[model samples]
Target: MRRSGFLSLVLASALAVPSLACAADHVTGALKGTNGAVHGIVDVTGAPKGVLLRLQVQGLTPGWHGIHFHEKGSCAPPKFTSAGAHVHAATPVVHGLLNADANDAGDLPNLYVAADGTATVELYSTLVSLKGGNNLPALMDADGASVVIHAKPDDYQTQPIGGSGDRVACAVLH
Candidate 1:
């Protein structure tokens, strides 16, 4: 009986090792925006199945900021406002919203900025990464799409941009 128990323990350990290795392979990088810079990192361990994204913005004014996945990963300014609205993968009709609907694929919840001009955000979406296409645009595509922070909050549902005005900052997810 003791030997059998020992074998089971060994099997459990063996199964756990691979999971830990995969978790370690999670990739990360920096996300640059217009007014300043922010820390953007992604852990794709269970990507397409599970994903973890974290962002921290510094030197930004305190307020509610709109965050979304844009159609291009290029951050070339004039603010890159021409990156063309939030990511919306819905068929037949494309709209943008932070709530569930046929809205923008990039319409995520608001990222609150602290009074000291710092914003920290962490998001886990079932949708795949920029390249996964499980609804998200390819971040590494040729002229890949970008993740943008807007000067206003996504009004949840409005029309043509959800009234999420002013592209404040942008980051190219390469």
Candidate 2:
């Protein structure tokens, strides 16, 4: 009886650990930019080393658009500055690459809209997390941030922030 009870307790503890870990591993949110008519959804899987963001978008202008994390997640008018600033986890502010060190935390690859004006993008960045050395603005702790769709592709290198044009739409991540 003692052996059976011990084994059962061990198994139960193992199962419980995984259930908690799985719950902590998942992060999700939505995207709403200036292009009010269309909206997108974002699902993020956070790992110890990196986080994968899978984005599905529709109702865009049908071309190259910048996808990034803005300063604030507020999605306010005239320039959603509330999302705060770019994430640029490793980007030191000199290198001009989305995955580079100087890049903002939100600097992601350019998103392409299909002829139908719909698009989907998947990206992974280690720059998101609370436990890791790298941390993104959008976490459960704060209001997080919004994923913004730019009117133009980010030029990759611009002063202060990327040359990504005005925000067409934004989605606030809770």
Number of backbone-clashing residue pairs for each candidate, in the order shown? 12, 26
Where model 2 places Cα greater than 4 Å from the true spot, the runs are: 1-17, 88-95, 98-103, 130-143
TM-score of each: 0.69, 0.74
Query: For candidate 2, lDDT tens digit of each residue in 87-127?
Result: 54453544236435464556677889899978877887655
lDDT of 1 by residue, 1-174 (tens): 999999999999999999887654354445555644553432223365435567767766578877776766567665776676555456534554444555456656777889987766678655435455555544445665666777787776766666767777776654
Candidate 2 residue 48 C-alpha distance from true site, Å: 2.3
TM-score, model 1 to reference: 0.69
RMSD to truth, every model: 4.9, 4.1
